[model samples]
Target: MPDADSNPGNGDGREADVVPGNQGGRASRAAALSVRSLAVRSLAVRSLATLRAAVDRIIPADSWPAGWEGGVAEYLTVDPISADRDLAWAWPELISLAGRLDDEAHRAGADGFASLDPAAQDRILAVVAAGSGARSFDALRRVCWEGYYASSEGRHPAGLDMVGFRGVPEGVTPIEPEPLKTVAPAVVQAHYDAVIVGSGPGGGVAAQVLTAAGKHVLVVERAPYLRNDQIRGDHLHGKRNAVYWPTVGPGPGHPRVAQLPDGDRVLDGTDDASVYGLNADAVGGGTRIWQGMAWRFMPEDFSMRTLYGNPDGASLADWPVSYEEMEPYYTKAEWQLGVAGEEGGLTRRMPRSAGYPMPAMGTEPSRELLGAAADRLGWGWGPIPLAINSVPWDGRAACVRCAQCIGNTCPVNAKNGSQSTFLPRAIATGLCDLLPDAEVIEVRDGTGSAGVTIMADASTSPVELTVSADVVVVSAGAVETARLLLASGLGNDHVGRYLHDHRTATVLGESEHPVKPYIGPGHSVATLDHVHADTIPWGGGVIVDLMGLLPLTSAGQPAPGVPGWGAGHKEWMRGERANLFGVFAMGQEIPLPTSRVTLAAVKDRWGRPGAALRKDVHWTSQQVEDGMAVQGARWLDAAGITDIRRQGGPATASAAGEHSCGTARMGTSPENSATDPFGRVWGTSRVVACDSSLHPTNGSVNPTLTIVANAFRVAEHLVAEWPR
Candidate 1:
């Protein structure tokens, strides 16, 4: 048997206890043994009974197997959630909730919650929802759904069938021909021409550029290299699932302190989406599991300050490089990464030198409905540019249009990320070595002796090593890159300032037609009309026809005041949830100097100070979101979709940090920015930042394409300036 350290499912590295036909008898026997052994290590009898009852109530057996019978209870008792390291703080509350359920049941004159009639149990649950136990109730409902929806690998297979979800396309699996070649810590060289601190879009592009130039490169990534098999498309537990914790992460030992106005709360990367600001930490970083929307910034986006002056307390600045300058690089990135999209009909006008390498993905049904609505509204709309293959491109297969995308890895190796493209190309040259599961704690800055202090196997038995490099590039995302510079005692006072991200609002409505949303990438057509609408406050954003409505994602918005559990909620899931469509608007937030990352007093397992965040999204960003929400609702109404509901906006400012950037912003001077125009850290010539951290202002669209383009530009510049 494999050791627990090697496991992805339950920590024993064994295949999970899936249902018949999915696994062999040995795995089935192990699951059976695990279920039987729960009495010793699982919840007490009363608590287990209460939990089982709760699960049944959340997802009742109307036309399908109930949550209680469909492996939910067993899933809760086993490896992933039960002994999850990151979710350790949540278990006590779950235990308490079980005990509280019985107390409530007794008040209602029942022997126990599980012993009460279904209707009676629901009445008590309603009382709990209205009372202080509301939070606990929500938690229970969430865990129940996660257990049911995320564990459908044979364990609740019927639930997926009922929802019209076809599993991974036939014969689809992880596409890497052999295991990814990685350099063991013992074999790593003490010196390199270039050492990149991340393996994300930026770092990957940099590696490809430098290695192709015959420069020896070391790519250090803190997270483990997640094989496709390891990234099981668990709806609630995968890398993209922000409901609890992202599977790929800043991990257990590396916690951040959110300095909220209420108080300083220590947070895991998954604690609060708005405040924690988590990007993936693995080999491809966010690219491995991203939705692959490759959007180009409008020309005006580069001149944010020139278009609309800064809002009060905002650090809005124009990028040192313009779209005209970056256009060639953008084209290069699009072609290299294999984007699929149609040209023209952009909402906000952007002059493109060339079209996408591949044609747009076949329009999803939701986009057709919304595109007609946009035509009626006289808004320019076109297919969303995506870094995913339409046909077999660059040796990768085309997307199978699986219901699961965004958070899940591409089973067919169609989703083009740094993992699939740049990194592999760099590795093929044998000039670039990737060091996964290694954390660069600090960069030693000097005139000619640039190097980094690395912690190998950071999550386990860590060993410190010092390695020298002629050039050092940091691409560890916005917050992490800023934190790294601060931790390394590098950069100026502006090192972690001007932090911001895209604030978004999603307007959901019941489509008049059956726009099968659970197919393909979440969004298809996006309009640029909102990108620079004068009617919008501060600035405008883009609106996309969004899809991918999983059971848990649907549960996030219950029908207004209706109880989260019981027959009414279940009915909502079956009817309204099934016919749902979404219009999502993402707005670029105003960067505030006050919104910064600093070194916190709290230390990690490695005894390093944690990143402290004081995230402040300006009111204008909220107004931008609100304006977009109004437009989205208008579009939905025009599309004849009724029962409109708005889920996000500036009100969700705390969680508005997704697509986060602009921490170590770029500028002309060291006094105002962490890095110069060429991505060189102001104070140090050898150290450079190659990620979105150098973004002076974030665009209204996704940043991956731009990050890749900019990294390519910067890497090319570095090679030209190399001491040849």
Candidate 2:
């Protein structure tokens, strides 16, 4: 029998109890009891020997499976293990280590790894498991863990329900109405019951609901649409066109700055036109570029004061409402967004009201191996709840299982983004009008009141328009929305303050087996072990699959000490692409008054004041690094991998720092937060800022679902307060 140490618990930290050989036992018990006992014991011993032999044939016995696929052995077959130079360089070393283990075991009169004493087995594993040499055992471990938990077989052992998923609240149907025909261009200026700025989650949902409520709505987007066949059927190009891409070097267009080591700052403000990461400027905003991993912040997340109380140097405060208050809205977002997956698992956080709209996406084979390893480690694993349709739902088709879903738009409409789901339905109701490529430069104060001034290209000629209404909604995302408010001087002092982003760190490795990485959603699984304060004691973090790599992005941004190009580089790329797997440790960045967005002296193509984003994240760096290391290690152990490589610490820039928030926070007092609980701008009656800018803190999860839910809450308030 395998020793207790060898038999680790599942990812959720539960003992693994595999049913004793029942392949044909129940039917043939009577005939084979006596003879079967002896044969079965012999077979068990032999099978154990074979497993050991296999382990010894490729790599060190101590180096167990680190990811979903089990180990480096399994990964090499399915993915590109030799692509990464470091991984390839370590291949021979791993083989040699395996041979040494086999020799050592044979000298001890053991046929294979299983025959060796448990202590000896552990000793042998210790050597290669240290992963001190050329290859990154840490990276391998992460891939194996991710691959295993993401597979069907692995999901089963982890107690993940692959088939059934209870989704959002019932009785909440899409408010679909009739479509309004486009008005004649020359007709008197068309009137609308409401005009929504920005076509992201909040704006999209608002448009759909208001139009369904029999009100005429106009949806305005600053970026041009990139759907259909205009861009070679690749959604990435569309995303690039819509998102604000920053330059690589210091340039006139660069609006952000990063402080580096040696006390010198590496100003990203280079003249190079190559774009870096930022929020999407298209109709769908960040949703078009997001990986679609949806998760609800724990009940405790909203009430930080009630849970851990306030901490110094942070703006931690309890939300105006509790989880129960937003519970119904959460369900509404789930159903409307068409998320797919199971609920009610021991490892998950949120409660479910009904099953998912469709089945879960297919699991990768690598996940199977990692699941087994996790079971041995006594950790719990669960199906990843995602905002993606696994089957046809509400006129949209199912996902095609592409590996490029990360940092790129879905070629098919399977991914439930605002553009594909809410906006279309809202447009179908003749009550809504979509004005693409219309940039609102300022929110013109309507003679001591609130209104907006918008600029757009009418037939490629600059056209300016003024809109006056009883209510004005601002949903221009965190950075842009804050800039717009500041530019218009609506609330300049509060507009660009308290900017925050989820600080991110990464771990990468090469596994033993092939993990077909590009087949499913970029992130099909995650671990929330440290997502709450109880786990980290000081701060919290969330773990998700690493974003897929584009060749240029990967080569250009190699990990420290990794060669960029050459024989070594080519080898590294080959292995890294196939066998490599990564993990992103995302932690909530505390809201700091110093970290802010400001208008630069420069101007954009539209002659608007260019927004300069300044981030000083040193305050929360220590907490983020510590939390990530802990959770990352746990995942590695669960995947049964010993070798590992990690990058990101206090010194590293927060990963992308793209999910920026808190520029216009929400609170009861205008002195602290920028808006009220109902998203109403303080000191104003009919002006509301309904976007991520209202987030008090960038909670340790994706902010989309929360943004949408809060928007619903705000809409309800607006309707209630509407002039009778």
Candidate 3:
């Protein structure tokens, strides 16, 4: 019935199947598989069939009273995790495993695995689960749970009533993600007074300060500000859907060669399938997404080498600027950004200049439990400072106390992200050009003649432009910022050296009474009791009482070695969702030269160099995290938590968190660091490093406040020194 022009097909009177299938019933089989995207390849049917036979052993339906109807293999066939390279690479092996198991069952007097009794199937699975087959088994299990428990069927009346999960409230109407191309045009000018590479907390603050000082600042951001429309409280996209990270990006597929014991494994940011490093790409950087834990480093954090002395295999050094000088800017950030907290309990290394602009956010049941536990154990505990409006500051609405806040856009415009704060203010000043989807490939001429080569988002029409500026401020984040500098051959040898991030550990506690961690802000309580080493190792950090994870993350992780699908994990969440609490260690890591960020062999999406990050965490840093994890477990026990599960310690594998920093490190001289005391690149007069990269070492607390404060400090210094 179709026109020949519109419906071009073979003249054989048959339609061609885009899905290349292997058998004569290929068309029929492929159609069935297409519904669940199991038609990714010709062997998809065989792969999925093999998978179903194998998955039954790990997550058996007969094991539960009202069990999941063996749809786990279907979920595994379509879940995002299943699409990734880690699983895809092992998928063939898994298929082989299924065949081998079936063959074994045949040899053992049974027809096959599916025909064998449950006992026999599990016995065969046990060998695979214990040995190298554990890799494929764990991968299959993770996706199975993610798909099953993250579905409406899994969180049914039977389960939801048990867990008391109201689910993420759907009051705020969701909108489509907005790219601010109309309001903020992509018109690249010939020149400007200054150019900032990123639009994060640091870059946003710097833009506000510099533009207010009457400097024409051009802010280049690789990602568009998706705005409030992107917030849907969908745990699938916002939370543990990516396991260790949120579903954000480095934009245009910046690949990295992460050092592994076996060999170098290449990670392409553009290719979601092979994600090794995760960083959000947007106008406001991480501030648009972070939960906002605002805290200043203790005095000892600055002078780590001065106080503890640099240990073996560590690159510890004193910051050129002191906490005393940074205190004014810290106060400025707190007041200007509307941070809320009281200035008492667990005495700090130094006193605050003034109390936080607003009072602390309301507490949850976990806070009470933690305080009581701390009191009983004679350990220090207190409320954490938050960057949300307690009583509606700066015309932003007050927080509605949303449960899912971390790594998500604020549902009610209550959160204080840079996109809502400094960038807006900077734009209002009419002196800053906030250009989103502008990826800076490199930074050159660090002195009076500075310039950057930028390309529009690859998804759009390619518009490569070279914008020159009098000054260059690279705050593209620790990794990308360092990569740009290294690519341009700017600054000293330390340009890409000393990459670091907080070594974290977490303890999930199951309380006797319902604590209901989903009632308040995601991060409401923390204690600075252990700012420095009192009894632990050389490094010290704060232990915070974090909110319970969303159901998606919770389902995947119940206890170590526990099958994520079927009975154990789902049953645990049903009984304990309300009573779950976590103790998180946001601790420090000494800068190590070996843990450096360099240019990777593989090019980015724009044909530019990618980052080759070598993260060599010292054994002592692991010791600090291990010690904190041990103490956190003890605290949970003291609070009368019946069951506690600890993750991350000395034995845990090293992976980068959202807080990775300190590649283009700042110091006094070119010999040691990339930037000077005022954050100006040592070899250049005006070009500077303004983000957490300016930090000589990552302090125990979250670095957003410090990054912004330093940005303000550098802006002030530039305002005074530069010819305005």
Error of 1 at 470 (Å): 1.1
Q: Backbone clashes per model, in order?
A: 4, 101, 1
Give the alpha carbon lDDT tens digit for every residue of 23-43 in model 3: 111123334444334334533
lDDT (CA) per prediction: 0.74, 0.54, 0.66
Model 2 agreement with the true structure over 1-724: per-residue lDDT tens digits:
0000010111121111111222110213333343333433543534524333433322232223212223323333232211121122223343444455555567768876556765676565555455452133323332222222222111221101111111111232222222223332232144455667898888988877777777676677766554422221121122321111111111122243232233422222211111223455556766765667666767767776566555666656667777888888888887888777666432356665556655666676555644455456554554566788788787765666655454445556566778777788888887777776566777653433455666654324546766665566788888777778777777636677877777666666656654534455655555666767465644577765554443323433455455432234434444554555556677766666767777766665456676665656544545776678666666765665445667534433332244667777788777767778877776666667888888877677778888888888787677677532
Error of 3 at 175 (Å): 7.0
Report the Cα lDDT for residue 235, model 2. Answer: 18
Local lDDT at 325 for model 1: 98
Better of 2 and 3 by TM-score: 3
Model with the higher lDDT, candidate 1 or 2: 1
Of 1 and 3, the candidate ahead on TM-score is 1
Better structure of 1 and 3 per lDDT: 1
Distance from true position, residue 574, model 3, in Å? Answer: 1.4
Which candidate has the top score in lDDT?
A: 1
In model 2, which regions exceed 4 Å deviation? 1-191, 228-277, 346-348, 445-450, 553-564, 575-577, 605-607, 651-656
What are the models' TM-scores? 0.89, 0.68, 0.84
